[model samples]
Target: MALPEVSDPQVLAFAAELAKNDGLVESEVLATLEEASVQQSILDAIARPAESKAWKDYRPIFISDRRIDDGVVFYGQHRELIDRIAGEFGVPAEIIVAIIGVETNYGRNIGRYRVLDALYTLAFHYPPRSPYFRGELRQLFLLGNDRLAYPIDQLKGSYAGAMGLGQFMPTSIATWARDYDGDGRIDLWNSYPDIVASIANYFVEHGWERDAPVTVRAVRDATARPVERTTLEPLLSVQQLEAWGYAPTAPVDAERAATLLTLEGPETEDWIIFRNFYVISRYNRSPLYSMAVWQLSQAIARGAAGDRP
Candidate 1:
């Protein structure tokens, strides 16, 4: 077969960077890029992320009876491993299950796109995030055969190149992925121990607080004024928010630093989110995503405890 044309300056520069950083031949990197197929659907998917939806709409997608029930089952099936990893990592097992449940429905539908094609399409065609995707593409090459259980060309994942049950990106796999099975290989796809432990480790690395509250519904007083939120980090104190007329419906330490979130539910919903909530946001950086994971974890916990059907 004739080699695909590779004259794009960005692609050439990326190949050079990969070769320089990893000591791989530039021609080989260019050959790999040339073989990658650019899918327009990947570009389209990136533009319309589910996080764009309102809380009312987004909640139904991941918080349905089916999802909650399945999460309970998944948690039950992996209870031993989950509990062990949770205790070792100081992260809750329910939160770990919820992360997998939200990311890939407990590995049923991890993704459809070939990771190479997805990263290549976004790296070369999507100008808005080209630099980021390009960096991922570089990391994909760096991951090599040892770290990845599957060959690079054969790996499949989300449109943004997030792999396995947790939908972890290249950087996450490099930094937070664990070999819990002790097989000296990190397979996020088939190994439940690796998957569960990797997720828990990620939470721990991002400062997950053991036994701390993630978020709580706030009863907004009629006289409350909207507080401006510039960042997701928990910056304001619970006392400060209470003074501003947003009191947690549930009890929390008054001195705890928190941030207020206003979500568009049936009616506008206010939440006093804590440091643990911020840790969940580190996984996806969307309040809606973090909230969905939190709510799903709660529902799953309830179901597992025989509180819900």
Candidate 2:
């Protein structure tokens, strides 16, 4: 195919920077960028992310019976691999499976957008987060063939440029993707060991506490004061929240640092979320996404156990 028209100064500057800082060929970088077409559909997709939906709407998208059942079957098939990685990384195996299930439906539909086009469109066209996507584009170029088994131009992933079964962004893959099968290169697409371990490694890197509770339903008393959540970090202690009249329905250490989240579910739902819940947010930065993953993980575990009969 003919090279795409490349007149954008930002794209030109990016090519130059890659050539100077990363020692890549400027002409080759330019050619690669030129080959990437700006995808309006990708721009549209990013504009309406699933995270924009309400909790009640978002939960069913990922937490369906089919997804839970598929996760159970996937776990059974990869039990040895998942368990070994989970033990090694101190992250629950069901959480790992749930992440994959939510991201790509057990690797069945990772994404359709060509990674090059997706990143290019976002980096150049999407103004709100252009800098971030530009940085990802830079990382994509930096991920040499050695680090990524696939050819850069041919790779396919989500509109956000997250690749693989786990839907990892370019920066995340660079930082946490592993060669678990002990092959010379990291392959998140076809390698089961690498995909599972990389996700577990990401959770461990983000401070997932072993055997710690993710979240619990909370009850707000009649006199409870509304607490605005300004951040996802577990800022208030459980005791402090209780003093404010929001208490966990289940027992937990009074002194443990936690955060209160109120979601619009079938009925308004309140949750006292712990540090592990914040770690999950590190993966997607959306409370709805984190909650779906956590709930899906629980459902998957239960389904897997019940499938034994």
Best by TM-score: 1
- TM-score against native, each model: 0.97, 0.96
- Once fitted onto the true fold, the runs of candidate 2 whose alpha carbons sit more than 4 angstroms away are 1-5, 307-309
The TM-score obtained by model 2 is 0.96
lDDT of 2 by residue, 1-309 (tens): 333467889998998888899998888788888889998889888878899999989999999888988999999999999999999998999999999999999999999999999999999998999999999999998986567878899899998899999999999998988889998878999999999999999988889899899999999999999998988899998999999999899999999999899999899999999999999999999999999999999999988889523
List the global CA lDDT of all models.
0.91, 0.91
Task: Give the 10-residue window scoring lowest on summed lDDT in candidate 2.
Answer: 1-10
Residue 150 alpha-carbon offset, candidate 2, angstroms: 1.0
Error (Å) of candidate 1 at residue 18 is: 1.4
Against the true structure, candidate 1 reaches a TM-score of 0.97
Error of 2 at 213 (Å): 1.0
